[model samples]
Target: MGEIAGGIATAGVAVWLIALSACDIRSRRLPNTLTLPGAAVILVVAAGTGHGLAAVAGAAALFGVYLTVHLIAPAALGAGDVKLALGLGALTGVYGADVWVLAALGASLTTGVLALCRRLRGVRSTVPHGPSMCLAAGLVVGLSATV
Candidate 1:
């Protein structure tokens, strides 16, 4: 029963990430319509699972970090990515600090790789990092659900 529930949760997160990825890739935007509600849902789930404090802490940590970067380099990181991180952080935080760290690392690495790839192709524009963030958090949650 636990495995079944885990699988369903993983699938749901994956779907949400995929939808966000598509939007970001298309318009370089992570709409509030998705990011805000997604964060609320994950936070509620964390609360129900007895990880409310951890989730809030994770969200704040991630949000603060991203917000700092956005403030320092608005062209390098978008407000949408920071907003997206709130939910992603909570989603990973429900598992533990380790998972949250891994998600953050994964997202950073993914974004770096994408930027490198674009630079190599002579496309100097900034890469929208929302997809990488979504991918990282989804992978973290899905992997945790399996274990």
Candidate 2:
């Protein structure tokens, strides 16, 4: 499981997720300032620790998938969300495919519930999905530890 089993990677991801969530919620933007550098750090650490190829491939694959979705419906997700997915993919990859699927499911459920609640409140505007991503990241990381 790489250093995520050691907890350092998970801790780093936790902090990064919090920052990303806060930025997205406050400004409805996930700045390149955060996601780019964060992705770099994750890649470097993963490579140095011998999970390089898997991490890079996972990030690329997830980024591509999300990018495709963004291309199809640009209004549904911004570039920032795609970038955030890259980082999350790498983090999840270190754990495994099961963890990745679980995290994605968690994110989807969180987002759906949040969206439903906002709709019930008569909010028709976009709901920032960054926090839901963070929630999923935390879930995957914590759950992976136990499993």
lDDT of 1 by residue, 1-147 (tens): 377876776677778899999999999999999998999988988888788999999999999999999999998899999999899888888778999999999999999998999999999888889999988887887778669
Which candidate number would show the highest TM-score if scored against the true structure?
Answer: 1
Q: Of the candidates shown, which would achieve the greatest lDDT relative to the real structure?
A: 1
- The 10-residue segment of model 2 with minimum total lDDT is 1-10
Per-residue lDDT of candidate 2, residues 45-141 (tens digit):
8888798887887788778878998999998888998999888888777677787778777887888898999999999987887788778977876
lDDT of each: 0.89, 0.83
Provide the clashing-pair count of each candidate structure: 0, 0
Q: TM-score for all predictions?
A: 0.92, 0.89
TM-score, cand. 2: 0.89
- Candidate 1 ranges with C-alpha deviation above 4 Å: 1-5
